[model samples]
Target: MRSNASDCDVLIVGAGIAGISMAAHLQDKCANLSFMMVERRAQPGGTWDLFRYPGVRSDSDMQTLGFAFEPWDDDQSIAPGGSILEYLRGVIHKRGIADHIRTSTTVISADWQGDQACWLVSVEGPDGPEKVRARWLYMSTGYYDYDHPYDAQITGLESFAGTLVHPQFWPENLDYADKRVVVIGSGATAVTLVPAMAEQAGHVTMLQRTPTWMSVGPSRDRLARVLRRILPRKLAYWLVRQRNIRLFDFLYHAARRNPHMAAEKLSEGVRKELGDLYSPEDFTPPYNPWEQRLCLVPDSDLFKSIRQGKASIVTAKIDTVQTDGIALEGGEVLPADIIVTATGLKLSLGGHIKVSIEGRPVNWGEEFFYRGCMISNVPNLTFVFGYLNASFTLRADNTAAYSCRVLNHLRTSGTQIAIARPPADGLVEGEPFPFSSGYLMRDLAQVPKSTDALPWRLNHDYLADCRDFRRNGVDDGHLQFELAPRVTDQSPVADQPEMA
Candidate 1:
């Protein structure tokens, strides 16, 4: 081990939206606190850098997707993938965030030492394995696995002659122009890929085992454009952000309250766009709206492609992967030059980094989510998990703000740790996530549940969280703050182990 090792007051894992937001917030709110961000990848942009698939874009609007402190001045509300990546990079450079980032550093495990009241994070950096000690640990790693996408098992895939591609690891030089492309999946990736690939591919076919509800709307935000023209830039951005927030909340709530009406409205829009091409059997999903996230298409691009005969949707089960294309259950064959599996991502927390206290492994599923940020009984740690019903950044920003408050409280109280102590009465168990999205459903067992009470429950309402995070105090009774006893000169050397 090196004589000198990196240590910080706070160690943030993952340099994605959450990590960047937390770092920026800590810098602004707790300027005196030393912190560093360790990202597994070589770059700062997490999702934007990871997914290089064609037609890759945010399912949510940029007004809400962009950081709260940073105003998105772009005319288009649904910005392209490249624009989002640029925005993330711009924030890092503009705020001098890169100085605190250690890219290509993967955190393998984090062990919290009760004696030291600090976490020893094991990370594999470019120089090899190293130890980093921090007074507090912030896990900003998102809920998906970056190393591998969800692998869908298909029969006879090895015998297929066509090129197979997954959107997660798109090839730069792979040619699909003027070639038959078949996208297998009915999620956002499939919806986005079919339309984008149709522009150049000879023809694109979306083969789905089940239908997913998709909403079509304009790419540009009319309200944002008008507000920008009439109002100051900051004011306009705030108004648009709030406007979109309310709009999304209302839509999601309405969908849950009245699925039949929501389904009709969603199906009607698709029918109107496709006209004769629309099939109720294919467009109408078995599940209600908001059961899974509604895929948003900008400018009706997917529908336009369908109408132009460049793209088509097929609702069927794949029986086998033929040499040239896919064979359906009923013996229907769809010839393809390339098969793109737009299957969803594999869900993982903290990029699959193992967390422990001493030597005992932490089972996240047993703990309650404290304020949707900190885990119950976990000291000096917070996770940035976004909302399922609204823009992800809404929750991201709130989590960062709340984390800053917690840090400030710990400093003021002369405490080294702040852990949530469950009430005498046990918490009421609830689902980890509100929605039943395939990704969440597939990995539900791994996620922790939320309690029924305040400061522990996963409140999906962003407005509630926004107000609570901004106006609420950090010394809530649920959180117990403590200062670890100082080590005396006569203390045994083995009592405090050396870092690796």
Candidate 2:
């Protein structure tokens, strides 16, 4: 509803799951709206495309992780990375929004123009840098840094005469056949790599400072397979999706509310899988369940590998990176021909884009997370920060629905600017995001602040958020609308040309 013309009505900044979901929502609900999606990578799939490491897969099930509009037709709920990438690509093509996306284009900066009531976005395409005006900006650029990962700081890493690899930048065809591999860190990546590399490697060892809680799950959903046979495809998908969403939401809340029972239940699963191989020092984590996500081992692959004598786990502090392998603090050396550093990702907010309001820079850390959607006092910008406990696309789908609501409101009400006003009454500060993962904890100061008040907290409960959004609606008095002077049929953004 900007008085001034814009290049597009809504400009999506990434072509990932989140961005594609927004596009689908717009395509279905607001068909006439002009929108464009820009992806830095040549491909549409974000994390799925970026991460190509061994045994790469989703920890969360594809049932709820996949978009609401699209039914994940695969039998394997805990799918491989390739399957996920294909599903994501299919969503855009099936929805006929492939033409709305521009690949190999990066959003460098976005500045809000108050006078024109639009965002002047700077993008670096293949040719050169260009600026475009948009009524709104949606950032789906993900939580982690694309180019770099968090440094593991492995001492004498360079001195070792071995193939050193990080999961982020997985090299092509660098064969490790029959090679002795030592994968550092006990996170999900290490759990995945140990078993995967164990298939062909002489032996694979998972080295960890502290043990992580592990759970056993099947890759294929047995009930989903049964339902698919009896019910229609779409209906089956919906039922399966809902079942998974509720199950995960329940488990996450249960873990937090009753950490003791949850921890015991989770450990029991591991003990059952490993049996004689189970050791308290190797499987028991110091932290409570959901403190850090319990790593999933589909079909007990990690445990199977250990039982089969193909892989093993060593719990000790890494003392140094020796010439042949890694040295432990207890003077034990682990021989390795290859070292895989599965040390987590680096969290980056707003895709590290320099955001400004006309000439003034915006400090995102100072802002409060308004209704877990928009940042406080920020106008026409929505960022998708997914759940730590549940599937990511659950939030992506919900965010798109909420975004459409805002867009519809703006068009119908004839408003130019819609911003989340900072809390008026004195509200005490709350936790920003309650996740205890090292990656998130390291960069806690970079994200927005949270408050004790309702609609001010950075919520993790998707079920609560979805219900609240549907029941309460957009006009909560916190999100203020501006420049509602006239009733005119003029649309600021003309229809976009097929993503050129």
Candidate 3:
């Protein structure tokens, strides 16, 4: 048992993109606030560090994916995982916030005391089990669990003779040279793995239960490059970012409003790129576009692999896994030296940290999301949840800026705690995410929901979110503020060993 002398006004969980962005935004706008960042992983890069699979890259362009305060001056707009990790490390060093971070520190639980107006955060640090006090709590932990991934649960998987791998935990010494690989699922991971492994492998087959819509574009943004040559750096970056945002909005609206026309346009584009090798039925998905995330392939690499006969796509159901390969329901067997499962991620909230308010555990599922940042009836705590439609950083940036505003308001009003309250009229119920991604659907019940009312419904549209989070004031009737009640210091935490 150790006492933490370095108390903080705010204790932030996870030192990833969202956490770093939050720190930067607060520093630029609210430098006086004392905050500390804690990460369970030894490194700062979140997804970028975790995923080391072949051809791992961002689905969204770097112009939007990169922090708003920092310009992404990289050569490729669809950056590789290594480059993104490097960029995140550079930001932490450049900002001089490295010392403020405690790596390999996992938060086990947080208990909010209304009387003291502080949260007793139980964390496992390098030394041992420790207790830290913070006036407020901020969660930058991403939606997915780092320690566990979703299990596909295929029958007789252990009987397979081939090497089994998941993209979430790619082996460091993995070699695929001259190997016949079969990748399961048709999402972004499968598309990326197929093209990349095809380069060295004897052949690669993509087996999917259902096809996903894919879009191919140049890895480098030619317009951004041209603009940089003619205009100032800041101006060029702004223009490029805005252009991509508008284009994403237009395409999403088109897909939602006119599914048939949108499908026709997407199919025509893919058909022209692949020529006779592509079939509309095989490439087309049953659901409308944007129903699930659209996979992006850089420079038609996937199509190139298929055209060269290095890779092929098969839609089938797995009856069982044989010693040699997977047997299909349609009486076909796929022979493979290796099998990769790119199924999906397992969603986690607040890094699975248990939260209690005055001895009662928080029911996150029953709570309403207030501005997609703070949970309803939860005091002085905020979680950063991004937009699924646009680049995640866009919403992350907005959430950070909005949080800064709320913090400033609290300071001005001399309030130690603030909670989101339901209005006199009840909120209309709706799904947490408008989209139907498998991961989202599987964990929808556990997540917090938003309503149709203002400051409650999280519209994925970037422009609307920007206006609401940035321009709108925080003193709306939804958030109820209060000062702390007079109380003595908190009791000592129980003596326990640090989590191994």
Residues 39-58 of candidate 2 have per-residue lDDT tens digits of 99998999999999999999
Residue range with the least summed lDDT across 10 consecutive positions in model 2: 491-500
Clash pairs (backbone) in predicted model 2: none
Q: Candidate 2, overall lDDT?
A: 0.86
Residue-level lDDT tens digits of model 3 in 402-493? 78887888777766677898787777777567688888888877788788766887577888877776566888878987666552245221
Question: For each candidate, what TM-score against the reference?
Answer: 0.96, 0.95, 0.95
The numbered model that scores best in lDDT is 1
Off by over 4 Å in 1: 485-500
lDDT of 1 by residue, 124-168 (tens): 889988889988899999988887889888887888898999999
